[model samples]
Target: MPIDPERARLLFQVISSCYERRSLILTTNIEFSKWGTILGDEKLAAATIDRIVHHGRLVEFGGESKRMGDSLMLGRQ
Candidate 1:
């Protein structure tokens, strides 16, 4: 699902304002490359990614979703 444009812009501005001077931890399934699609602006996405990547460590976990696993187990029960 795509993020709301106004919310995305608000989040972008908040992140920009708080860049480097504070700590932020964002967990998202969306890749930085696709942030433009989510945020509705490639330029804003790039800038947001630049700020985040500059200070944050990228940790990716590859596997099936935990929620999916739980749902499957529940269905079987």
Candidate 2:
């Protein structure tokens, strides 16, 4: 897949600006090490990563449950 680096940079800028003084949440199945490759642009990816890491906290979220029903069962465990 082709990557438009300029658009990535602009989008990153927009996200950073929006997050500067407000709350934001992002959920991603893709892990951090794969981001630069997914981005397909080294510079823009680096910049984006820098912005995100600066503005966000990383936590270890545990295993996935398939459904709300499963979650309820797990809660009782």
Candidate 3:
């Protein structure tokens, strides 16, 4: 689902305010390219991403989801 416009604006404000002044750690399963659709604004998404990646370190993990391993229906088939 796309983010609400007002909330997206608020999020941008928060990120902008924190940019270069504070450290932030954001975790998302969504890819950077889809941020425009998620935020519902391409410009906002681009600005957000630009600030984040400018001083950010990306750490990617590979393997099955931990949630699936602990799911109740894992072996129900």
Instruction: Write out the backbone clash pairs for model 3.
Output: none
Model 2 per-residue lDDT tens digits across residues 1-77: 43576766676777678666776677777876777777777676677777777878887677664675467656833
Q: Pick by TM-score: which candidate is best?
A: 3
lDDT values, one for every candidate: 0.87, 0.70, 0.91
**Pairs in steric clash, model 1:** none
In candidate 1, stretches whose alpha carbon ends up further than 4 angstroms from where it belongs are 73-77
lDDT of 3 at 42: 96
- Model 1, range 1-77, lDDT digits (tens) per residue? 67888998899898998898888889998877888988888998999999998988999998977787778667931
At residue 2, what lDDT does model 2 achieve? 39
In candidate 1, position 40 carries an lDDT of 89
C-alpha root-mean-square deviation, each candidate: 2.1, 5.3, 1.8
Worst 10 residues of 3 by lDDT: 68-77
lDDT of 3: 0.91
Q: What lDDT would candidate 1 get against the real structure?
A: 0.87
What's the CA error at residue 26 for candidate 1, in Å?
Answer: 0.4
Stronger candidate by lDDT (1 vs 3): 3
TM-score of each: 0.81, 0.61, 0.91
lDDT of 3 by residue, 1-77 (tens): 89899999998899899999998888999999999999999999999999999999999998978888777787722
